[model samples]
Target: MIFYFSGTGNSAWVARQLAEGQNEELLSIAVEIDKNKEYKLREGEKVGFVFPVYAWGPPEIVLRFIRRLKMIKPEYLFFVCTCGDDTGRTAQLFSSAVARKGWRCAAGYSVTMPNTYVSLPGFDVDDEDVETQKVHNAVARVRFINEEIVSRVQTKHYNCHEGALPFTKSYFLRPFFNTFLMSPKPFHATEACIACKKCEKACPVNNIKVTDRPVWGDNCTQCLACYHICPVHAVEYGKVTAKKGQYKGRLLRDL
Candidate 1:
C-alpha cells in the first residue's frame, strides 16, 4: 500500500502517479485519520509513504498516523517527500521514525514541487511556468522511482541533504514553528466567502467550521489547504497574505 498525506495536492499527485506506475494501492492518510482506522500492510506487499516536507521534517499528522500504524512484516518500505526546494534531513527523520516502529526503511527520496507555504514571508506559490516545469520534472522522477521499487532495489537513501543548518533548523526551529506558529488564530474569512465549506472539508485536521463564515479553531497544521482551496478567494492569513496568490495543485478532475 502507498499512503499519502497532502495539503495542497502536490504529494497527492505524486502518490497517485507512483501508485499507478507500480499498480499499488493508494490510501489517504488524512481520510484514514478522519475515519480512525489502523492500517496493516498485507504480507509480501511493499509499503510506501509519501508526503510533503514541513519545516524540514515530516508534518505532525504524518508522524502521529505512522505511530498508530500497525504493519505486518513487509517485503520492503520506502518514503518519498515532496518539497518546494531542498529536503533538509527529512529523509533521515522519517527513517528514524520508522526504525523506532521496528520497520526498516529501505529507501527515501525527495521531489521538488511548487512552493505552497505562503503564510510566511519570502515564500509564495510558483508562477504558472515554474509550476508546470516542476510538475513535469516530478513526473519523470516518480516514473524512475517506480522502476527502482519494482526492481526491489535495496538503495537506502536518495535526494537528501544533511548539514548543520539543516539539522539545527529541523530539530530546533521545527519545534518552535510547530508549537507557536501553527495556529488557526490568523485565519479569517472575508465577504467573498460563499459558505461552501470547501475550506472546512479540505482541512485535514477538521480545524475549520462553516456557519455564516468559516471559523478556525486551535488545531491547525499550517498546511494552507483552506487558503489554497478556497474557490472564491475568501480565506486570508492575516494581512500578510492579502495580495499573495493562492495555489492548489491540479486535482485529478483537472487532469
Candidate 2:
C-alpha cells in the first residue's frame, strides 16, 4: 500500500501515478491518521510513502503521522516526494524519522512540480510554460521511479533533486522555518470570499470550519490548499500572497 499526503494536488498526482504503476493500494495519510488501527504486511510486501516536501524536508504532517502509525514490520519500503524546486536532504531526514518506527526506507525519489509555496518573499507559482514542462517531465520520471521500485532498488541517499548546499538548506534553514514560520495564524479570507466552502473542503487535515468565513485551527499542514483552491482567490496568507500566483495541479489521465 502507498500512504500519501498532498496540498495543491501535486503529491496526489504523483501518488496516483505511482499507485497505478505498482498496482498498489492508495491511502491518504490524513484520513489514515484518524483510523487508529494497526496493519500487518504480507511476506515480502512493499510499503511506500508519497508526499510533498515542505521547508526543505518532509511535511510536518507526514512526520507526525509516522509517529502515530501502527504497522507491523515492513519488508521492502520506499518513498516518493514532490517538490516545486528541489528537495534538500528531505528523504534522508524522513528516512531517519521513519527508522524510529522500525521501517527501513529502501529507496526514495523526488518529482518537481509547479510551485505552490507563495507565502514567502520571491516565491510564486511557476510560469505557464514552465508548469506545463514540469508536468510533462514528471510523467516520464515517475515511470522510471516505478521501474526502480518494481526492481526493489536499494540506495542510501535520496535519488532526488538535490540542489546546491543541501546540508545548509536542509539542516540549517529548515529548522528555522519549522520553528518560527510554519503556522496558520497568517491565513484569513478577504472580502472577496463568497463563502463557497472551498477552503474548508480543501483542507487536508480538516483544520478548517466554515461559518461566514473559514476558521483555522492549530493543526494546519501549511499545504496552501485553501489558498490555491479558492475560486475567487479569497484566501490570503498575511499580505505575502496577495499579488502572488496560485497553482492547483491537474492530474494526468495516464502515467
TM per candidate? 0.93, 0.96
Error of 1 at 163 (Å): 8.5
Put down candidate 2 lDDT per residue, 1-255, tens digits, no spaces: 899999889888889888988888899998898788897777787889999999899988889889988988788889999998989999889999989988789999999988899988889999989988998999889989999999999986769998989889999999999888888999999999999899999898999999999989998878999999998899999999999877867544443
Residues 32-130, candidate 1, lDDT per residue (tens digit)?
866656566666788999999998999988998888887675679898999988777888889888888988888878888888988887788889899
TM-score of 1: 0.93
Off by over 4 Å in 1: 34-40, 161-164, 251-255
Provide backbone clash counts, one per model: 0, 0
* Candidate 2 Cα errors over 4 Å, as ranges: 251-255
CA lDDT, every prediction? 0.84, 0.89
